[model samples]
Target: MRLAIVLYPGFADWECALLMAAARTHLGVEIDVATADGATVTSMGGLDVSPHLSIDALDPAGFDGLVICGGTVWDTAEAPDLSGTIRTFDRDKRLVAAICGGVNALATCGLLDRVEHTGNNAASLAALHGYRGQTHYREQPQALRSGHVITAAGTAPISFAGEILRGLGLGSEELDGFLALYGREHVAATSAG
Candidate 1:
């Protein structure tokens, strides 16, 4: 699968990393990390990641899926009209996944209407109210799969990645392999408690 991960100036590094690791270790998929521009992108935590393509340079038809990374940037700065790009991909029936505040970006693009979604904060949840879709909030990291739109609550990277894998026609067993490769045993144990 050819996956495109949206990167902004202040995205979360761990979010991108986990998804990339899952794509690489589990699905054995070719992943491309892209930014609004071809420039290097930084995370909210000050980590920098280089991009494989810029939004302007990417051909939406070439990607199998697009994963938008969310953080403080989604709330403050204006993101590229990713909704249009996502809509184009959706028209072709490609998979689109958003995490945390990235859902806000998708909402702005009119993609969340009539789709079930969850976000990181109360503000994001409130934003979803104006959307045409069923909005839900839960404590557990749950992946709500509604057709082509795949969403997850905040900090649910494992579940989020699992959802993406499943959407790509992979299995939960692949997600487990990714977790093991990433040395997420401690996190799994802690969360399981």
Candidate 2:
């Protein structure tokens, strides 16, 4: 499976690093970086990435999903309105995932209005003009997948990754174990033979 990770200036790079590593290492998912203008974007951590694919250039047919990394730009007044690209992916039945401030984009696009989604909190979303999905908002520390959309708080990348895998039909016992190891203090269950 192939996934496109959308990045922006001042993005939270660490949020998706473990997810990308684990998914690619375990599931063999091909992950690519995409930016707003097919140029380089610097993360909040000062990591620079030069992406070849522009957000407008992504073809939903060619990629299985779009994972948007949270960035401060998303919370600014001049946030990128990703409605068109996001809707295109959703229209084609492809996975649409976002976390932290990235969730604001989904809120701006009104996808969260139709599905149960979680982010940093519901109060923050209420500030957005396009957000009318308050009733559908779920307050949780983990990532949630409703229909084909996945949303998460910034602190829940491990959970977000697991949900992404689950959304991609890659959920399994091993996957659970994989996430458990990363998410918490895992306790292994033993079977009596």
Candidate 3:
């Protein structure tokens, strides 16, 4: 499977690290990092990311899913307008996942208005997010998947990645193992002790 992961200046590296690593190394999925201008950008944690393509250049038909990573940039006045790209992905029924501030992108595109979704918090984002999806919001600590759309808080990368893997058709057994390993590493250590 191929996934187009969106990135930008101040992108939250922690929010998507596990998802990308696990998806690539364990699931063998192909990932293409996209930026607003197809150039290298620095993450909030100071990591530099060189994107493979520009978000504006991507064709939804060429990929199986889209991943929009969280970042403070999404809350700013100059957030990249990814509405067209997100709409195309949704129209084609491809998996569309967004986390934390990335949820603002989907909300602004009106994709969350009909689907159950969660993010950092609804109240804090309501003013910045003028979208009408409030009634469907679920205040969960993990990621929530509705139909082809998946949304999560910034702190739940494990659940976020798990849902993405599950949506990509990974078997339950494999998912269980993945979650077991990542979701509860301390359990394994304690059990071994």
Write one digit per residue (lDDT tens) for candidate 2, span 1-193.
Answer: 9999999999998778887898788789998899988999999989999886899889999999999999899878779989999999999999999999999999998888889999999999999988999999999988999978999999998999989989999999998987887755444677899
- Higher-TM-score candidate among 1 and 3? 3
Q: Is candidate 1 or candidate 2 better by TM-score?
A: 2
lDDT of 3: 0.89
Which whole-number lDDT from 0 to 100 does residue 49 have in model 2? 91
**In candidate 3, what are the lDDT values of residues 1-193, reduced to their tens digit?**
8999999899998888988988889888999999998999999989999999999888888998999999979878888778899999999999999999999999988998899999999885576555899899999999999988999999899899988888878748877777778777445454454
Candidate 1 total steric clashes: 2
Candidate 1 per-residue lDDT over residues 110-167, each given as its tens digit: 7776666666654555554345443444334566677778877667777688778788
Top of the candidates by lDDT: 2
Q: Which ranking of candidates, highest lDDT first?
A: 2, 3, 1
**Residue range with the least summed lDDT across 10 consecutive positions in model 3:** 184-193
Q: Which of the two, 1 or 2, has more lDDT?
A: 2
Q: What is residue 114's positional error in candidate 1, in angstroms? A: 1.5
Estimated TM-score for each candidate:
0.82, 0.93, 0.93
Cα-based lDDT for every prediction: 0.74, 0.91, 0.89
- The TM-score, computed over Cα atoms with residue i paired to residue i, of candidate 3 is 0.93
